[model samples]
Target chain A: AQTVTQSQPEMSVQEAETVTLSCTYDTSESDYYLFWYKQPPSRQMILVIRQEAYKQQNATENRFSVNFQKAAKSFSLKISDSQLGDAAMYFCAYIPNFGNEKLTFGTGTRLTIIP
Target chain B: DVKVTQSSRYLVKRTGEKVFLECVQDMDHENMFWYRQDPGLGLRLIYFSYDVKMKEKGDIPEGYSVSREKKERFSLILESASTNQTSMYLCASSLVTGGWYNEQFFGPGTRLTVL
Candidate 1:
């Protein structure tokens, strides 16, 4: 079984500033994947970014980037040029390379953007 | 665009009552998942189905059951609803084509409250 953890329960960032949400996972598999998902007040879960375990370079999507440290099992999400729209409950998820397609998610970090 | 829709945005049920949550996807995905989201528990997988009439228990399936009669629809059922079962239920669907990096699209979620 794989588990993901988000240390930060809540985070705040000013508009146009940057913020990072911490996440870590426990897995024995050599090949797996990590993802950052955003859930807005509308209750829609949207994919922010994703990184493959085999890839050394972290994944970046527009203003969102991940610092994936496979050795430490840490996958943190960095949000740059933050906007009011970025305020949401951000979750870190893990998926193995085989067997199942279900995702294991972290406790989540509630991000607030101060305008 | 892949669209996943849940039958209800909000549901109120009584304890010991049978509760049903419906989910439908438009992309004809091969996989569908049911998850419960709480304040501290981000998303706990309840059940998942890879194909029609094939369902698998996830990490948290003690009080939940699932049905997949059609390729596009997946339903989660609570045999006897309890106060502990009051949470946000989310449905997601994804294709198995992109190897192990398959991405899932989620619905708006159903907030169920058991009294």
Candidate 2:
């Protein structure tokens, strides 16, 4: 069984600033995929970024980026130039290379963007 | 754009009532999932289907059943709704051509309150 943990239950960042949400997981597999998802007030979950465990290069999507440390079992999401739209419940999720690709998600971090 | 839609955005039911939640995907995805989200608990998968008429139990499947008779639609059923089951239910779809590594498209969640 695998599990993801988000130690920070809440995080706040001023508009145009930067913030990072921490995540860590327990997995014995060497190859897998990691993802960061955002759930807004609309209750729609959107993919923020993704990283392949084999790829050392971090994944960046516009203002959203991820620092994936496979050895440390850590995958953190970074938001730069944060905007009001970034305010949401951010979740760190992943699926191993086996099974039905069931996603294991962290407890989630509530991000608040202050103007 | 990949679109996933849930039949209801909010539902209120009584204990011991039978509940059905419908989900439809327009992206022709081969994999569909049902998850329940609770505050500070993240999302816990209840069931998933990789093909029509085929389903697998996820982390939590107690008192729940699913149907995937058609490729574009998946349904979750709570045989006997309970107050403990009051939570947000989400539906997601993803392509499984090679594997389940693709990003999942989520629907606007159905918030079910069992009174």
Candidate 3:
């Protein structure tokens, strides 16, 4: 079974600054997908970024980017020019290339944007 | 815009009561999932349906059942609600493109309280 771990339970970043949330996972599969999701208070959970294991290049979307290290089994999310709207609970999830198409998620990191 | 909506944002129920949580997606996705979120635990999959009347047990399916009579709607049922079952329930939908899966779109979530 694959397990995702988010060591940081809470993270805070000043407005307009940058923040990085750490995540690690255990999986033997060579081809898979890693994802970062954000859930704001009383709001829907949305996809932040995604990285494919076969792709060496990291994934970037707007202010959100991912540092995916396949060898280390590490996938981290970096938020640049953070704003108050970035304050939310962030989760790291994993899914393989094949099979049931279910996601395995980490415990999550609560991000706080300090103004 | 792709939208997945839950029946309620907040629900209160007593122990042993039968609870049903409804989810509907406007995107005509082929896959739908149900998950539960807790403070220290990330989103745990409870059940998922690939097609109408085709359901599969996810990571945690105990005390929970699901129904997918229609392509756009999926329902989760708690045969006997318990305090341990009180948590935030989330519904998600995604498409299967050429045997590959796409990123999931989530609902706002329903917070259920079992007293």
Candidate 4:
């Protein structure tokens, strides 16, 4: 069984500034995948970034990046140059390498971008 | 672009009524999942199918059942709608790359209200 945790229930970031959303997971598997998903007010869940356990390098999208520490089971999402469009509910998710590809998600963190 | 579509954006059903939620994916992915999103509980997986007729129970499956009769379509069924089951239901699909490294694409969730 796997569980993901996002400590921050709500986060606020000023436009053009940077913000980090914390996430931690407990998994027994050595190889798995971590993902960060953003759900805006439109109610669509968009993939922000993904990180593989074997790869030490964190994943980075245009304005989204992750700090994945395999040892600590921490995979925090960093939003750089935060924009108004970034305001959403962010979820940290996990998927193991085998069996069904069901995702285990953490309690979301609602992010508010302030101008 | 990978497009996952759900049948309804919002639905209202009376308690004890049978409910059906449909999902379709255009990307021909081999995996589909059903999840419910509550305010503080995040996304809890109800069911997932790796292939047609192959289904697996997820963390929270007592109140839901699923069907994957085709590669691109999946359905979630509520035998009897209950107030506690009212929430945002999400459908997601992913290409199976033989493991868990595949990325999942989500649909604009279906908001179900049981009255």
Candidate 5:
């Protein structure tokens, strides 16, 4: 079955520190896309970053980056200089290159930034 | 900026009652999706529409149906809301593209309670 797995259900980081959330997906399709989404307490989920499978360079936002290992089907998100406002449930998702446009998301990892 | 809005942020209904969750996007997107977010199970897709009047089943569509009569509007319906159907429902929309990324914008989720 095609699925995404987030190994860490909960994680904590000191304010201004850094943390990484791990994700792995099982799929046989060669063309796909990976994404990290942040859901705040307000229940608004926003896209943090996106990674295309064909791109050798990893995707990076302002302070959010991804460590994508296509061979192992692992795509992890790294949050640098974490802030208290960054505390939220982070989800890892996958979508194929086709137009079906279905996104498979992993069980989220709740990150708590301690002050 | 892309904006996705849901009709409700919180809803309460009795079992066996019908429930309708509406979503609208302002970006003229071609795809809309409905997903239920659970504590440990993650976000499970219930339905999606690639265009007006066209819909497809997602990973979990047993208790749900969808309508996309207008290009900017998509609605998810629960024929008979059950106790097991109580969860956070999220609506998202994305533009149609052929490349590796088609970023989806999400609305504030609706937390439904079946009592």
Candidate 6:
């Protein structure tokens, strides 16, 4: 079974600054997908960024980027130019290339945007 | 835009009560998932359906059953609710293209409390 770990339970970043949330996973599969999801208070959860294990380049989406280290089995999310909208619970997820594509999520990190 | 809606935003039930949580998705997605979120545990998949009338148990399917008579709707049922079942329930949908899974869109979670 694959397991994702997010050690930080809470993180805070000042407005317009940058914050990084750490994540690591245990997986024997060489090919898989990793994802970061954000869930705001009483709002829908949305995808932040995704990284493919086979792709060496990290994935970037707007102000959100991921540091995917396949060799170290680490995948961290970096939020730049942080805004108030970034305050939410961030989750790291893993899914293999095969099977039912069920996601295994880490214990979330609650991000607070300090203004 | 893809939209997944749950039947209730909040629910309170008594122990031994039969509870049903309904989820409906738009955009004709082929896969729908049910998950429970806790404080220290991110999201644990309870069940998922790939097609109409076809359902699969996820990582944490114990004490839960699912029904998917239609492609757009999936229902999670707790035959006898317990205090341990109190948690936030989330519904998500994703597309399967060429045997690969796409990004999942989530609904505003339902917070259920069992007394």
DockQ of each: 0.61, 0.62, 0.62, 0.64, 0.70, 0.62
Clashing pairs in 6: none
> Which regions of candidate 4 deviate over 4 angstroms?
B97-101
Model 3 pairs in collision: none
Model 6 chain A lowest lDDT segment of ten: A95-104
Better of 2 and 6 by TM-score: 2
Better of 3 and 5 by DockQ: 5
Alpha-carbon TM-score of each model against the true structure? 0.96, 0.97, 0.97, 0.96, 0.96, 0.96
lDDT of 6 by residue, A1-115 (tens): 7999999999999999999999999999998999999999889999888888889999999999999999999999999999999999999988888866678899999999999
TM-score of predicted model 1? 0.96
| Residue B79 in model 3: lDDT | 99
TM-score of chain B of each: 0.96, 0.96, 0.96, 0.96, 0.97, 0.95
Once fitted onto the true fold, the runs of candidate 5 whose alpha carbons sit more than 4 angstroms away are none
Q: Model 3 lDDT vs. the true structure?
A: 0.94
lDDT, each prediction? 0.91, 0.92, 0.94, 0.91, 0.92, 0.92
Q: Say which candidate scores most in lDDT.
A: 3
lDDT of each residue in B1-115, candidate 5, tens digit only:
8999999999999999999999999999998999999999999989989989999998899989999999999999999999999999999998884455478899998999999
What candidate 6 gets wrong by more than 4 Å, as runs, is B97-100
Error of 4 at B26 (Å): 1.0
Isolated chain A TM-score, each model: 0.97, 0.96, 0.98, 0.97, 0.97, 0.98
List model 4 lDDT by residue over B1-115, tens digit each: 9999999999999999999999999998988989999999999889989889999898899988998889999999999999999999999998984364478899999999999
